[model samples]
Target: MFQPWLATLLIWIPTLVTAGDPAETPWISLKPENHNGKHIVFVTGDEEYRSEEGMPQLAKILSKHHGFHCTVLFSIDAENGCIDPGVLDNIPGLKALDDADLLVLFTRFRNLPDEQMKHIADFVESGKPVIGLRTSTHAFDIPNDRKYHRWSFRNDQWKDGFGRQIMGETWIAHHGGHGWQSTSGIIPADMKQHPIVRGINDGEIWDPSDVYTVRLPLPDGCIPVVMGRVLSGMNPEDGPCEPEERDGKTFDKNNPIMPLAWVRELKGSSGKTQRVFSTTMGASQAFTREGSRRLLVQACYWCLGMEEKIDGKGNVSIVGKFKPTSFGFNSHTKNVRPKDLLD
Candidate 1:
């Protein structure tokens, strides 16, 4: 039912840009450019859970080709898909989370409420810098509240609440069902120089959801960059299935394998360091290839360090087009260029 003039023409079609027209626009407003700092990006999801997938076109392509200063918090009411109403009084104050440097969780099974889950656990313990995509590691589930019952990894107080010490692990299950493969081709040779895997090569097979398997054990000095190979499936809300086995063929038993992406460090017992970057797989729109949208826009520009602001001079277009309202929920608007939606 969301069609407020296509969400106000997809929030003003990024803000048209046609000087020489290289074509890679989408930054409607939030000024502050020349950015080497000030990264603020908070985009929640669950547009009716899976209403055709697009998550505000990946938050308008990370605030228009990565200059990032975005703020798109939306749970859209969340119901049978598990509640999430406006993440704590519709967060976005505190001078915009103290001019947030980064935080891009993409919700899916949220159920917030306990004073908005302690204001999202005190805004991820205030350490800052996070980028969990795909079901945001079981987002947030309040079985009956009880302070949010460990957030969910099947439950058992998994990570001891607050989204497993801030997204180290929570929702495990994906034995590779969507398609494609090849992960972590063993890149940890001192992180291949890091900087988010420089350019990222070795095998390369982006665009294909569902890939997890890092049980739990990251947030300490966390830094595992990328590790692949385990893919099976099963997490479509985990229900109705059959066929199982692990080291002996016969998969599909509701697919339950793991580890699709990683990069962490959240020490914080008060020490404070935070900086996470998980990825069970981009919340499907059918993989949006281009190496899965440049591996989720280079893992959100290396968890907000900006990774030199990536613009290698090619491929970065994602203009606008969301359409999917049958009540399922999907209306990111549709401004191809109506004067860039009246910018």
Candidate 2:
């Protein structure tokens, strides 16, 4: 008779070793056929708006449909190795950024250690392209005394940190009513022919997340691509917002829509100008719409200087079943590891 307990122990030891090993940073990587020879790394750690849930879905689309190698790194619980967006400090597998051609960042208020942050800093300094989604504008909240404090969203020296210096804006107040209003995309008249908005039509893109306020005219070298019309309700068929008194002034939200999406050409420390795509709407619920998914897919091609290759009606179908958790604070699904998404 074989000893069942002894056999189980031997089988379990290897699994324990791999999970406990510090060298093995937990992450999910998706490889694509018909390789485009580019690697896109996604950093997801936002508490609300569900970057943790959305980034992976986006990565899968990029890989399975577009032929880019996509890797998604999430904030992990130290004690149990589960994906935990509430953990504001640690996001393992950032070293993947070293070889990344483009970075899709959606972190909010992260205060990672210097060693982990150095990887992101080095990548940004390399003059590579970047895509900033929703809360990424206010991504870091490092203390003033920290080594990478300049990246903090509220730093005096850096002047709004990476969001302002690189992505063209930082955390301003919500332009639309947070939960009550929705955002409808409008292609700027001048930008209708732009490659990024190639296949998308006005009003096709809608997100439940409200528009964020950005200072007027945007910054130098930034071009607005999509304007967001504030809607009266969360449904796509909802009417445009009515005139209301706000900030002691009468305002009509739809008259002058906010910049929903834009592109920037910023000079990095390496003396090279890199392309950046920033969109104020990328909540997990946003991608449920076909227009929202198409816009992002095309933007990735545009960022990589492959704009000419974008198919106006390319396949942006969901890779597999994707039922994302609703956007909220402290509502992330617990005990779920990055590896769990491999299925």
Best TM-score among the predictions, by candidate number: 2
lDDT of 1 by residue, 1-343 (tens): 8878998767554443322332222212243233335555555645433422444455455556555555444443222222233332232222344456676676756665565556555566777777776567677666755766676535665553444556666655654443433232234567766766555553342423445555555556556665544323222223233455868988652233234567877667567766788765554452444444566667677666666755433344564654323212343332232123212
**Native-to-model Cα distance after best TM-score fit, residue 297 in candidate 1, in Å:** 16
Candidate 2, 53-161: lDDT as tens digits:
7888888888877788888899998898888899999998899999999999999999999999999999998999999998889999999988999998878998999
Model 1: weakest 10-residue lDDT segment is 334-343
Error of 1 at 19 (Å): 10
Q: Pick the lDDT winner.
A: 2
